[model samples]
Every structure is written in C-alpha cells, then in structure tokens.
Target chain A: MNVLEIRGLSVDYLSAGGTVHAVDDVSLDLRRGEILGLAGESGSGKSTLAHAIGRLLRPPAMITAGSVVYHRKDEQVDVLKLAPKALRAFRWKELAVVFQSAMNSLNPVMAVGAQIDDVLRIHEPDMSRKARGERVVELLRRVGISADRRKSYPHELSGGMRQRAAIAIALALNPEVIVMDEPTTALDVVVQRDILHEIRTLKDEYGFAVIFITHDLSLLMEISDRIAIMYAGRVVETGTAKELHRSPRHPYTLGLLRSFPKLRGPREDLLGIPGTPPDLRDLPPGCAFHPRCQSAFDDCGRVSPRLLPGPHGEVACLLNENTGVEVQA
Target chain B: MRFLARRLGFYLLTAWAAVTLNFLIPRMMPGDPVDLLVARLKGNVDPAAIEAMKQAFGISDANLWVQYVDYLGNLFNGELGRSITFFPTEVTTIITGALPWTVGLVGVATLISYLLGTLLGVLAAWKRGSWLDGVLPVSTFMHAVPYFWVALALVFVFGVTLRWFPVSRAYGLDVVPAWDGPFVSSVLYHAALPAITIVIASMADRILGMRNVMVTTLGEDYVVMAEAKGLTSRRVMWAYAARNAILPNITSFALSLGFVVGGSVLTEIVFSYPGIGSMLLKAVENEDFPLMQGIFLVISLAVLVANFLADLAYVVLDPRTRQEA
Candidate 1:
C-alpha cells in the first residue's frame, strides 16, 4: 500500500528574473514501511518535491499544481487542502521531516531533551512532565545517545550526535512517515554510515515509511528498498534497489552510476556527467536531459519521452519508447 | 568563574578611565567654578572671604597633581564636593534627589516600549505583508523623529490642547513627596505626557530593529525545524525565533537602560521635569564642576553595569556563549 501518493506535482519559484519551474510535473509513491530513496543532482528539485509533499514550502515557491494524498489505514487526506490548524495536527503526528543540516536545524538555545520533549508536550498534552522527561531519556537512548546528553545543547553535541538527536525528534510522535532530506550530507563518512545503520534499525523496529532524499546514488543503493532517480525536476527512473543497481534503463541513471567511484572494480577512468543540468527557468527543447545525455538519438531532441514501464521498473527515456509498455506522460 | 573575573576587571579599568576623564574634562574647560561662584555674588564679598570661600569649596592654588589626588580621595570617601548652582548643597544630595525621577519615568517608559515594540515586531515579521507590517514604517518614522520634538508635540496636544496631563514637572507642587495615593497619582499624571513621548519615540527603533532581526531569524534552520516539528505558529514565533532574535535587542535594551540614569536630556528639558537630565543641564550652565563630574561618573558606572548585566544575560540565554566562556 502506498503511504504517500504524489501526482503531477509542480512547484514554481517566483524570482526577480521569472517564474522558475523548480519542481516540474513530478510524480512518485512512498510505500508503507519502505525506504524510498530519491536520488538527484543539485537543482533537480528533489528537496523542493520533498518540501512540497510535506506542505513546507514558503511563499515565492508555491505548489503550482497537483495533489499529495496521504494514505492511512482508514482515510485519505489531501495534504495540500488541509486548513492551517489541521495541517499543524497532520504534521509530526502523521509525517515528520528531518532536515539536511542537523547542526543548523536544532535550536542552539534549547537542550536536546527539551526539543524532543516539546513534540511530546504538543501532541501528548496529558503526559506528565516527569513522564515526558523519562520518554526523552528513552528516546535518546534508543537513538544510541546517552541519557545524560539530553541536557546538552546542539552546539555541545558532535555532528553525528546532533543528526541522531534530529532523528530522535522526528520519532518523538512515532509518525508513520519520516522525510529525511540529506540527513547525513554534512557528516563524515564513518558517522554517516553509523547514522544510516541506526536509521535502518529504527525503521525496522518502528515500521514507518521513509522518503530519503539525497544526491548520492551509491548511498541510496545501500539503504533504500526502492530507488528513484530525478533529473531536471522530474523522476527519470525508479526501480527496486537491486534491480536499479543491476540494470538501469534510463541513460541519465546510467550516467549517474558511472559518475561515482566504486570501492572494488576493474581499474577504469571515472567519467562524470559532462554538462550541467538545464536551467529550470529556460530548459532546452524536448527531453531536459538530452543536452547532457551521452546516447541521445534524433527523437530524444524532438520528442519528450514519457515514463514507461520497463523490464526493471520504470524508465523515462526514448530508448524504452518502443518497448510495448503503457506510457505515462 | 574566570570569565566573570576578567569581565569585572575590564569594568573596573573602564570605570577608572571614565572617572579620570570626568575629573580632567571640567578642569580643562576655560572657566573656573570658583570664578563663576564669585561672579554670581557680584564682587560684594571681600577678597579674603573669596579666598576662604574658594578653599571651602575644595578649589585651591595648589599644584594640579595635588588637586587630582584630592579629587580621587574625595571620590573614594563618598564626598562629591559642593554644587555651585545650589551652593551649600552637596553634589551627591542633588544627584540623589533627582535619580529616582529619571529612573522611574524613563526606565519604565523604555522597558514598556521594548516589551510592546518587540511583541509588535514579532507579529509584524511573522505576518509580513499584513496590516501590522504596513504600520511598521510609520512607527519607524516616529522613532526617527527626535525625542524632544515628540515630547513637545505630546505636551502641546495632551497637556495644552486636551488639558489632560501636566506639561511640566514630575508632580504637582501642591502634592507632598509621599507614598500616599494622591501624591503617587499626581506624579503619574504629571509624568504621563513625558512617558508617552519617550515610549512613542523609542518604540519605532525597537520595533524596526526587532522586525529586521526577526525576519532573518525566521529564516534560520532551527525555526524552520521547529515548524517542521509540528509546533504551533505561536511556539515557532516566540520559543524558537523570538528567543534568538531578541538577543541583539537585549544588548540595545541594556544600553537604553544605562542611559536612563543620565535621563533623556532634551525630553526632560522640554517637559521641565526635575530629573537628572535637567539637573545636568543646570550643572553645565552654572559650571558646577563637582556636580557635572558626579553626574558623569554615575552615568558611566550605570553604563558599565548595564553592559555587564547584558553580558551575563548573554551567558545565561545563549549556550554558545557559555561554551566559549
């Protein structure tokens, strides 16, 4: 069952220059109890999509179109249409978000324990202060942080610890879905590995879906149950992690795979994607990735390729156009 | 503890420099207090009596070093010499008599303005493009207008035209200085126009400053994080954003509090209130060296103390500062 169904979502930023279509008609699904990794380069609008789904985008960046339907056991909620009060209640209780930079995200003036307890205080008003304090301790301990570190401020904690605290806060209400936008981007490799491991363990224990957004395809392959690759504000391909790793149908996905260095493989020159992403304000004609795609054909520059079902999963490239599958434009 | 000790040592050094400057400034001025005193008497007193009067007032033909030593000694011994404007009255007594009025009127007004202005600022920034944001510019313009001008305008409208409040003085002359209701009410009634002027004039800067700071603070990741945590908009504004945005405003508040001892000079003059600002003006006009020095010393000390208190508040409020300490 899909926990979140995002359809034809579009977000535009009204800048001084013009209205930049930051997140052009994009669509994807986050399944129940699954880690759906959203992999994309900078300016691809992955973060914007994540924020749009959460209804967290500020003005100047508005949802131009589409619906975000949050599916629970007995009801379906169109998240974008929720009133301010209802939105407040819907967030954290149903969907919590962990931001990119943990150090910057946690309030420097507040203690970690108090920050986590604040969530409990708001959602569970009946809980006693003593009980809240104990829950905070348990939450901290669950995140592999010592109970005593609860009193420490964000600046007092190491980067990894702060990230863990952020995750702890996300888990405070035991929300069904947690959206993490590059939660480990700012941490060192070892710390990143540890945090990712902790997240996997916690997710298994809590049985919650996660939309993990990052630009690192390698990292996504390690943890995500399913991986979705986004390009120029649209998802170009999505498949089971193992299938996507073994045989990526989209040329852009293949380019992304080639860009990263492998730990153990035959010695070969690393080739990064040659050209930068198309400007959202003035994208090139036809397929947005055609300019940067290495294996572009005649139709690739004239006709935009729609997402079509491929043997692996779904691919949005002209290479799979005539594969006798239903196309979704 | 060491950080506190270092801060204390720094304040003490500043106090010494301030006191030294205070002692030197009046002496450097062209005229002498003794001459001013003697001229006021219109040469009616004998020359010998003049010398004796000068001696009594702690002015002598002794070396400059000797006078400096005596000044420092007198300062340490709590003797601020005599006030030439109000002869036979000690400088300390004159200052003490007016301190409460300035502290009560200006201090209360400043605090009220800060509280009210900050609250308005937070709301305005949180709801930018709203009606409150529209009024912010007018408040900023009001702040930019001189306090004395505001005081005078308030006096003209409320005191003169409306006949609602007294234009001049801290209290009605008919009321005795007592803790009784009538006396207190009279003081408050007289102080209303001046207090309102100060609040109106000072509020704009606080509001504008807080609004700008809040706009930036609201952009901070922690505030966004707070919002993402599903906290109410109120909690995001007050607990997350305002708590941090208010730090810079706190420093400004302390500086304003420090100036409260010196009082709003022009505002006091416009209102003719018996506060330290009016007293300082009189001291300068009469060249009352001891009184001028005393007022300067008190103002400097108040500033230093307020600054130290602000630092202490920073330590308490910001964990980052505590870690650095």
Candidate 2:
C-alpha cells in the first residue's frame, strides 16, 4: 500500500521581480517499507519536493497548488489541509524530514540528546522523562552514535555523526515515512556508505518507508528500489533502479547516467550536460529541456510532454511517441 | 573555571585603569577642590582652616606617585574622603544615601522596558503580518524622541496638568521616608512619571534590536528543524529562535544595568528626584573633585562588574563559550 500519495504538487517562490516556478505539477508515491529515490541535478527542485511533502516550505516559497495525502493504516489526511494543531501533530509524528547540510539542521546551542528528546517529548507528552531518556540513548545507538555523545552539542560531533543525530531525531517518534534531503552529501564516501547501510538496516528492522532525495544517481542506484528523475522542477522519468540503469528511456536520464564514469568500463571522457538548468523565473515556452536536448525538434519547443507508460516505467520525452514505443498514460 | 579566572583578571585590570583615570582626570583640570571649597567659604576661613581643608581633601606636598599610593591606600580602606559638594559629609556616605533611590527607581524602570520591549519584539517578528507590526512604528517613535522631552511631557501631562502624580521629588513631602507601606507607596507614586519617561525613551532600541535579530534567526535552519520536529510554536520561538537572538541583546542589557549606577541624570533633574544623577550634576557644577571621582569610580566598577556578569551569562546561554573553560 502507498504510504504517501502526492498529486500535481506545485511550489512557487513569489519574489519582487517575479515568481520562480520551483516545483511544478509533480506526482509520486511512496510504498510501504521501500526506499523511493528522488534523483535530480542541483536546481531540479529535489529539496523543494521533499520540503513540499512535509508542507515545510516557508514564505516566498509557497505551495501554489498541491495535495499530499498521508495514509496510515485505514486513516488518510491531506497534509496541506491540516489545521495548525493537527499540522504540529502531523509533522515528526507521521512525516519527519532530515534536511540538507546537517551542520545547520540541529540547533547549535542545544545538546544533541536534548534535540532528539524534544521530538519525543512534544509528540508523546505523557511519556515519562525516564522513558524518553532511555529512548534517546536507544535512538542514538541505533544510528551508530555512542550514548556518551548525547551531551555534546552539534559542533562537538563529527559531520557524519551530526547527520546521524539528525536521523535519530527523525526516527524518535517512529514516523511511517522519513524524507531525507541530501542527508549524506556533507560526509566522506566511507561515512556516507556507513550511514546508508545503517538506514537500510533500520528500515528493514522497523519497516518504515524512506523518500531519499539526492543529486547523486550512483548512490541512488545502489539503494533505491525505484528511481524518479526530476528535471527543471518536474519528474521526467520513473523506473526501477536496475531497469533505469540498464535501459533508461529519458534523454535527460541518459545524459545523467553518461555523466558519471563507470569504474570497470573502458576509459572514456565524461560528457556533462551542455547547458545549465533553465531560469526558474522565466522558463521556455514548452519543454524546459528542449534547448539542451540533442534530439530536440520544432515540435519539441512548442509542446510539453506527459509521462507516458512503458515496459520499464514512464518517460516524458516526445521521442518515445515519435519512435512508436509507448502510448500516453 | 579557567575562563572565569581569565575574565576576572581582565576586569580587575580594567577596574584599576578606570580608578586611576578617575583619580587623575579631576586633578589634571585647572581648578583645585580646596580653592572651590575656600571660595564656597567666602574668605571667612583662616589659613589654618584652609590647611585643614586641604588635608581633608588629600592635598599635600607629596609627589604624584606617593599621592597615588595614598589614594589607593585610602580606597583599600574604604574611605573616599569628604564631599566638597555636600561639605563635611563623606563621599561614601553621600553615595550610600543616594544609591538606593537610583537603584530602586531607574534600575527597575530600565529593566521593565527591556523585558517588555524584548517580549513584544519577539511577538512582532513571530507574527510578521499580524497587528503586532503596528507596535513597530510606536517603538521607532519612542526610540526617536529625546529622553528629557518625554520626561517633561509626562511631568506636564501626568503631574502638573492632570494632577494625577506628584510634580517633583522621589516621594511626597508629607510622607516619612521609611520601610513602611505609606512611604513606599509615596515613592512609587512620585517615580511613576519618571519611570514611564525612561521606559518610553529607551524600550524602542531594544524592540528594534531584538526584532531585527529575531527576524534573522527565525530563518535559521535550526528553527525550521525545530518546527519540523512537531514542537509547539512557543518552544520553537523562545527556545530555538528567541533564545539565540537574545544573545546580543543580553550583552547590551548587562551594560544598561551597569549604567543604572550612574542613574538617569536628565530625568532625575526634571523630576527633582533624590538619585545619584542629581548628585552627579551637583558634583560637576561645584567641581567637587572628591565626589565626582567617587561617583566615576562607582560607575566604572559597576560597568566592569556588569561585563563580568555578562560573560558568565554568555557561558551559560551559549555552550560554545565554555570551550576554553
């Protein structure tokens, strides 16, 4: 069963000059106990999508239109429509997000343990202090941090450890889905591997789903059951990790896969994407990716394409239609 | 603990330097305190009385270094010499008599302004588009107006015209100054206008200061994380945002507390209140070197003490400050 059902969600950053279309008409699903990898380049709105899921977008960056239905057991609630009181309960209880750059995620003044304990105390007001204290230690240990490190502030811990502490806080209330936005980007490769391993082990043990958002496609390929490629604030492709890797349909996804050098393959120079992502404030008339696409035609510049169903998954490029490989969904 | 000792040592050095400046500046000026005293006496005093007056005021043929030693010795012994402004009265005695009223009235008034302003500023920043934004312009106006204008306006409106409060003095003319209720009420009644003036004039800086900082910290990642953690708005505001934002304000607050020893001179003068401020003015006007030096010493020491206290508070408030401790 799907834990989170997101449909046609759009986020716009309203500024003095003009509105920046950050996230536009994106829809996805997170099944129970599965890692759904959200892959994109830097300005592809990966973090925006994650923030939108929790309704954590601040002023300027507003949800122009969207509906995020969080399903738990038999109950369903549109996260966007929750009242302030219900919204407070909805966050960290049903959906917790570990933000990008862990150095800034946790409060610098508060102790690591105190920050973790905050989530528990707020969500479970009637939980005893002793019980909360014990849970903090357990959570810390679960994330591969020593119990003694609890008293240390965010600065006191290593970068990887700080990220782990953030995860521990997210895992405090045992939420059904955890949205991790570049949670391991700040750490070294070895530490990142360790954290990803810990996350997988914990997910296996707890059976909680994870929406992992990152620009690192290789890491996503290693961990994700299914992968969604976002381009210019919209998901351009969606497929299983192996299927997308072996035979990616989207041209943008193909360029991304080609950008990363394979360890075992014959030596070949990397071909990074030709141009930067489009200006979010003033996007192209039809297809945002057409200017950079090698296969762009007259029709490609005049019309946007929807994600059409295929054998592996779906692709939004009109090439699939021209080739007569798949029909529109 | 080491950091505390280090800080304490630094303050002691500053305190010594302040005391030396206090002792030197008054003497460096052209006129002598003995001359001022003799002029006050109107030539009636004899040469012998003049010598005695000079001796009482610590004027002697001793070299500057020896006199400095003597002054330091007198300070260590807690004897601040006689006040020329209030002749025959010990400077220490005069300060002791005046300090309680200043501390009780101006100190508490300034504190109230800080607390109320900071609270309102936090609310204003938290509710950016709410009616609390209306409080911002008023804070700016209060900040812009001169302290004395507010004091005089309040005195005219609340005291002279309205006849709601006493026109002058720290207490009623008929009420005995004591630890009793009637005397205390009279003191508070008289202080109301001056206190309101002080608050109105000063609270703006704090409100503006705190609001600017709160606006900045409210956008910090930690505050967002706190909110995402399902914590209440109050906890997110005070604990995560306001707590951090208040750090800079706390330093200024401590400095203001130190300035409380100097008292609100203009306000005190306008209200004719019995406080250190009026005495300080009188001392300056009379060129009462001993009293001026004494008041200056107290103010400097209070400032040093306040800075030390602020350092202690920072160590408690920000965990990073304890790194060297």
Candidate 3:
C-alpha cells in the first residue's frame, strides 16, 4: 500500500536574477512502512521535493505544478490544495519532517522537552497536563535522553542528542509518513552511525514510513530499501538497493556509485562525476548530464530521455532506449 | 547564582567609579560656585562672607585628598549639601521634587512605545509581504527624523493650532498638588502631548529593531521546525520566533530604561516640564556643584542598575548566559 504519491511535482524559486527551476517535474511513491532514500548533490532539489511534500517551502519558492496526495485509511488528501487553517492541522498530525541540520533546528530559547510537548499540546489537546508530561518523558527516554535533561536548553545538549530530540519531536504524534532530509549530515561519523542504528530500531517500534533525503549515496545504500538518484532537479534513476549495486544503467548513477571509496574491498581510486550540474535557470537542451557523461554521443545532445521503467527498474537516458523488453516512460 | 553574584559585583564597581567621576568633574571646572555667586552680586563683598559661603558650599583648602574623603563621607551620610541655585534648600530636596515628573512622563511613554511597536513588529514579520510591512518604511523614516522636531511638530499642530492638549508643564497651575483623583487626572491631561511626542519620536526604534530581528528569526531553522511540528501559527510565532527575537530587544529595553531615568533634556525643556533634565540645565548654568554632582550620580547609577537588570534577565531568558558560571 502507498502512504504518499508525488506526481509530476515541480518547484521554482523566483528571484530578480531569474526563475530557478529548483525541482523539475518528478514523481515517486512512499510505500507503507518502507524506507525510501533520495540521493542527490546539494542543488539537485531533493530537499526541495521533500519540503514540497509537506507544503513547507517558504515564499519565492513556489510549486509551479504538482500533486502531493497523502493516503490515509479512509481517504486521500491533496496537500497543496488544503486551506491555510487545515494545512496547519494537517502538518505534524498527518505528516512530520526532520529537516536538514536537525541538530540546530530546536528552538534555542526553549527547553527541548517543552518543544516536544508543544506538538502534543496543539494536536492532542484532550490529553491532560500530567499525561502530556509522562509522554514527554517517554519521548525523551526513547531518544536515550534522561528525564533530567528535559529542562536543559538546546545549547546544553550535545549535537547527537539534539538531533535525537528533533527526531523525537517528529515522532510525537506518530504520523504515517515522516520525511527526514539529511537527518545526520551534521554529526560526526561515530555519532552518525549510532543515530542511524537507533533510527532503525525506532522505525521498527513505530512502524512509520520514511522518505530519507541525503547526498551521501553510500549512507543511503546502508538503510534504504530502494534508492532514487536525482540530478539537475530530476530523478535520473531508481531501483532496489540490490539491483542498483548489481548494475547501474544510468551513467550519472554509475559515476555516483564510483565516487565513494570502498573500505571492505581492495583499494580503488574514487572516480567523481566530471562536471558540476547545469544551472537550473539556464539548463542546456537535450540530456542535462550529456556534457559530463563519458559515453556522450551525437544523440545524447539532441534528445531528452524520459525515466523508463522495466524489469531492471528505472533509467532516464538515451543510451538505454534499445535495452529491450517492456520499457515505459 | 554565582553568575548573578559576578554580575552584581561588576555593577558595584561601576557605581563606585561613577560616583568618583561625579565628584571630580565639577572640581575640575574653571571656577568655584562661591566665586560665581559672589560675581553675580556685582559689588565689594566681604572676605568673611565669601569664606562663610565657601564653608557652607563644602569647599575647603585642607588639601584635595582631604576634600575627597569629606565628599565620600558626606555622600554616605546623605549630605549632598545645599544648592546654590536655591540656597539653603537641600540639593536632595530639589532632586526629589523633580524625579517623579521625569519618571512618570518618560517611563510611561517609553513603555507604551515599546509595547505597541514590538507587537506590530512581530505581526509584520509573521505576515511578511502583507500590508503590515507598510510599517517598515514608516518606522525607518520616523527613526531618522530629529526627535525634537517630532516634538515641535506635535506642539505646533496639536497644541498651538488645534488647541487639543495642554502644551506646557506637568500639570495645570490652577489644580492643587495632591494624590487626589482630580490632581492625578490634571497631571495626565497635560502630559498627553509630551507623551505622544515621545511615542512618535521613539517608537520607530523599537519597531524597526523588533521587526528586523523578527524577520531574521522567522528564517531560522527552529521556527521552520516548529511549523513542521504542526503547532498552531500562534504557538510557533510567539514561543519559537518572537521569544528568541525578543532577547536582543530586552537589552535595548534595559538601556532605554536607563534613558528614561537619565531624562530627556529636550522634552523637559520644550514643554517647561520640571524634571531632572531641567534641573541639570539650571545647575550647569549656575555652576551649582552639589546639584550637578547629585544629578550625575543619579544618571550613572541608574544606567548601571538598568544594565545589571538586563544581565539578570538574560540569565532567566537564555540558558546560554546561565551556563557561564
């Protein structure tokens, strides 16, 4: 069962310089209680796509065209069409987001516990003060923070603990879908692995689906059931972790795979992608990755390939047109 | 608690330095108050009369150190000495008479300005790019305008032309001075114009300070996190954005509180309001050493106390400060 469906979503940032197509037309789905990893470089619009799902993007960054349909047991909600008041209620109770740099995302002036309780106080008002207090303690405890640290401010907590606090706040209402955008990007490797392990534990306990976005493909491969690679604001390829590891058809995905060094295997030189991404405001005609692709040929510069799905999963490249068997764009 | 003690210790040292400067400044000035008084008489004055007057003024030739010790001792005993401007009337008595007027007028006006401006600022940032943002340019202009000009403009339009409010003094001369309702009402009636001028001239600072910070804070990751938590707009706006935005404003408020105690000299002088500002002017003109020292001492001490209070407030409002000790 699908928990969320994003169809033909596009996001643009309007500035005096020009309108930046931050998130070009994209589509994907979040299955019930599954981890969906979105891998991309900084400007690939993965974060923008995540924010658009929750309708959390600020002004100047508008959704030019899209439909974010959130599926509940009884009905489907068109998130972009919800009114302002309904939108407020729909956010945390229906969908929660662990924003990038979650460590610095807790209010500095407020106690971490109060921040978590605030979500409950608003969405679950029928709960008593004592009940809410107990819930906050439990939330903190689940995140491995002691009850006494509840009164401590964000500055007093270590970076790892703050990130956990942010995640705990997102899980306060236990919504069906949680969007975590680079949730561990700010922490060191040691703490990052520890938190990632805890997240897996918590995910099993809560049974909530996650849309995790990150630029580190290696990290995503470790936890994601399926991985989607984005480039120039478009998803270039997507497949099961095992399928992508076995054979990456998209040249961009091939380069991304080789960008990271392998510790377990014999030493090999990291082959990073050749050039930077094209500017969103002025993308060249044809395949956006043609200029950087090592296998670019005459047709690669003349045709813009669409993401085609087949038995091998999805790949958006002109070279894969003749790969055969039931391919659909 | 240890942080508070450190903070308090800093204030105490500041007070001592302020009092010392207050004592040294007038003594360093060109002529003694006694000479100025005798010069005003414009006749052959008896040397005995001058000597007697010098003794009464707390001036002595027993060496500068001896006089310094005497001044410190007298300050402890609450013996600020008699004012040359109103000789035989205690300097302490003259100051006490003016403190209430200044406190009432400037303090209340600053309060009204800060509250009204800060509230509008938060609203403007919350509904950013809305009509409420119209306040930004207006506040910028008001903040740039000469403060006294705003006062005079109000005086001309409202007091002189429309004849709406009383233009001068703290209260009407016809009213008997007392704690009765009528007298209190009369005081308020006359204070209206001056208070309005203060608000108009000064409210812009509070508005811009708050609005700009609020706009910056609204961009913070935490505010966005709060919204994503599905908290109401009100909860996210106040507790997350405004609460943090208000920290910078608190320090500004405390410093402005010091300004209230220091008294607005132009506001006092323009309306002939009898506050410390006017008294300080008189003391300087007459070289009333005791009165000058007394006013200086009050202004500096008030500033130190106000800053101390701001520091104390930070410890409560921000855990970062409390972590210092």
Cα error, candidate 1, residue A79 (Å)? 1.4
**Which residue runs of candidate 2 sit more than 4 Å off their true CA positions?**
A261-264, A324-329, B39-45
**CA-lDDT, candidates in order:** 0.89, 0.88, 0.88
User: Which run of 10 residues does model 1 chain B get worst, by summed lDDT?
Assistant: B316-325
User: Candidate 2, residue A99: CA error in Å?
Assistant: 1.3
In model 3, what are the clashing residue pairs, if there are any? Answer: none
Query: What is the alpha-carbon interface RMSD for each candidate?
Result: 0.8, 0.8, 1.0
Give all TM-scores, in the order shown.
Answer: 0.96, 0.96, 0.97
Docking quality tier of candidate 1?
medium
Ranking by lDDT: 1, 2, 3
Clashing pairs in 2: none
Q: State the lDDT of candidate 1 residue by residue for A1-329, as single tens digits.
A: 99999999999999998889988888888899999999989999999999888888888899989999999789999999999888888899999999999988999899999999999999899999999999999999999999999999999999999999999999999999999999999999999999999999999999999999999897899999999999888889999999988777887877787778865667656677888988899888888998887777677788888988776778888877864433221
Task: Candidate 3: list runs displaced more than 4 Å.
Answer: A322-329
Interface CA root-mean-square deviation for model 1: 0.8
Look at candidate 2 and tell me the lDDT of residue A294: 79
lDDT of 1 by residue, B59-152 (tens): 7768888988999999999899889889889999998999989989999999899999999889889999877878677986897787777778
DockQ ranking, high to low: 3, 1, 2
Give fnat of each prediction, in order: 0.79, 0.77, 0.82
